[model samples]
Target: MGSSSLSRWLRPEVYPLFAAVGVAVGICGFQLVRNICINPEVRVNKEARAAGILENFTEGERYAEHSLRKFVRNRSPEIMPSINGYFTDPK
Candidate 1:
């Protein structure tokens, strides 16, 4: 209604209720923001961890195959380069 009537209604006791409502809203908004902001990072971190584990699993097989090939090459030192040189020699 009138400014004087509104001013009279706005007593000091109303401030605590307004402050409590503001605090509750702030806490709820903070939780929502945290969920929105932090959830993707958690998912990406989990995917990255899974990828790292997969890489380790595959690399173990790769290293075993590489070592086996190296051992075979050491036992027969005249095959790879000889085959390549014969096939690719310009002269």
Candidate 2:
């Protein structure tokens, strides 16, 4: 087949594939933005506070401090050896 004929045959098939890929990319981008922009914990805390269900600012402050402390504790050097052992063999 001539180059012109091949191009003619392939051009029609390529468009729908490109359109589907574009739609998939757009969906993934939206999900990425939603995940980054929406903090579920903060949203819930704000809603609860607005509803008068939360008594004081100290509640959220305490939760935040506890989460930070837990995160730091998990990352301590003493924990690394056990974490690394999970990937290695017994021998």
Candidate 3:
């Protein structure tokens, strides 16, 4: 098609649609880069390993256990028995 015909077909109303698509594409590209390139490495605590808090078979499980132990340790002592009960008791 001629440039004039194409320009006539692509009206001003479609500019907003193009702008929205461009913004969406830009956001997706930014997130893709952020996830792949700019991701921060998680530093595992040496103390947790020394204390045997992360002795689980898998790395993910070990990290989870270590996080739970750290969470419990940081909380009040009174809450320990209840937290412990949740694991020990059936109900």
Candidate 4:
């Protein structure tokens, strides 16, 4: 890679564009894979949808009953809660 091209890519305005493009590509890939493989509806017929007959395991596994899920749900949705708490602590 030449310095000219590297410098062009490294500019401040160029980063948000790159980040946005990267995010868009990632989301598109994820959606495509999910629809093709993970989504059971992709294999189901219109009659199944109309009849409300789908996989029962999907509903059961959608929400986990594990202790970690419950613990996280009740806590603040922070990336680094411990670090945030440490900085904000009075003690």
Tens-digit lDDT track of model 2 for 1-91:
6999878757877889979989999999987775555533344445554765435567556645666577777564655777687777476
Q: Estimate the Cα RMSD of every predicted model relative to the unseen true structure.
A: 25.5, 10.6, 15.7, 5.7
Top-TM-score structure, candidate number: 4
Preferred candidate (TM-score higher): 2 or 3: 3
Better of 3 and 4 by lDDT: 4
| Candidate 3 pairs with clashing backbones | none
Per-model TM-score versus the true fold: 0.38, 0.34, 0.38, 0.49
* Candidate 1 residue-wise lDDT, 1-91, digit = tens: 6999988768897889889999999999987885555433333455565754343556455544665577787565656888888888988
RMSD of 3: 15.7
Count of clashing pairs, candidate 1: 0
Better of 1 and 4 by lDDT: 4
List where candidate 2 sits over 4 angstroms from the true fold: 1-10, 41-91
- Model 1 bad stretches (over 4 Å): 2-5, 40-91
Q: What TM value does model 3 have?
A: 0.38
* Local accuracy of candidate 3 as per-residue lDDT tens digits, 1-91: 6999989768998899989999999999987775554333332456543564433347555534565587778776775788788888996
